[model samples]
Target: MLQLGGYFKLIELGLEDCVSDIDAQPVYGYALYKDGKGAKLFYPLEKFNSDVSGRSFHNGRFIQKMREKAVTLPNVRLEQGTVTSLVEEKGTVKGVQYKTKSGEEKFPMALWQY
Candidate 1:
């Protein structure tokens, strides 16, 4: 049930539209640890392959698409503020407390927190 809900959220977050291609090939490479001190890796979103990679979309592209879709939703409102804390009760999140330019505000997220 939780997995299904997560799939729906991905759709709501515009995962389909953000993905420019679904058949992109994977870039074959591995992380190299130089002298057992530093490591380097070059994995870009465009080089992702669903057949090989665990993640479907590149994180940055996914985030950009979600933000674009969020603005079009009637129920979802974009808030410009720094989140101070999350309200929780009985180990469940109930709301989010954030500070805006005008004042501090509390927005209920009980329906989605679980």
Candidate 2:
């Protein structure tokens, strides 16, 4: 699946059968928040002391790196499909339900959010 200018090879909705280890490469960006008065506040990510340098955080580059690393793993399968919905129990998310060209299915999702 493609999202946020990045291409994702989604087998499921989670990371259980996906990436082994992920590194935190902080990217600098601004978040816009609106107040009750309709005034917008622009918060720069770097100012929050997260140590983001705005250097190694290119979307396309990151996606390419992930794709490269994923191919090197054993028994990794990338399913071409569309996520129909998330399987949630109470307040916890269990997995995801997706639909491919063949039919609909479900898998144990290890990761839920980006």
Candidate 3:
């Protein structure tokens, strides 16, 4: 998954530092079990190159890092809320409708167009 373009895009967005330490406790591999016995052991290092083999990390930490990096950008805005639905126009997603602690809000995509 780390070999995908989206991961590189994050690096391009100035998140290279965050990527290195995204997880507090990194998982390099995993084992599968059946009938209380180890069925198979899988390790990225054994199967793929170091560059493409990605480690598993805490998802919460990943989100935190992404939010932290996004806030530093001038054009980004972070909102805390539940996304009720997507606001689409024609066939494209044009915006989002969400509910915050205070009230419901609609954010138009045009506001962020560059």
Cα lDDT tens digits, model 2, 59-112, are 565565566657677856565567887878897877777778788565645444
Model 3 — which ten-residue stretch has the worst lDDT?
A: 1-10
Q: Report the C-alpha lDDT of model 1 over 1-114, residue by residue, as the tens digit.
A: 113234445456556444444332334334576666766564443653343332344566656666777788777767677777888899987777777878867564443633
Instruction: Name the better of 1 and 2 by TM-score.
Output: 1
True lDDT of residue 94, candidate 2: 74
Q: What does the lDDT read for residue 95 in candidate 3? A: 70
Candidate with more favorable, higher TM-score: 1 or 3: 3
Count of clashes in candidate 1: 0
Residue 106 in model 2: lDDT? 55
Quantify all predictions' global Cα lDDT against the true fold.
0.54, 0.47, 0.61
For candidate 3, lDDT tens digit of each residue in 1-114? 243344446556766556567654334455687888886544435554455334456667777877897898898887777777877779887777777878867564342566
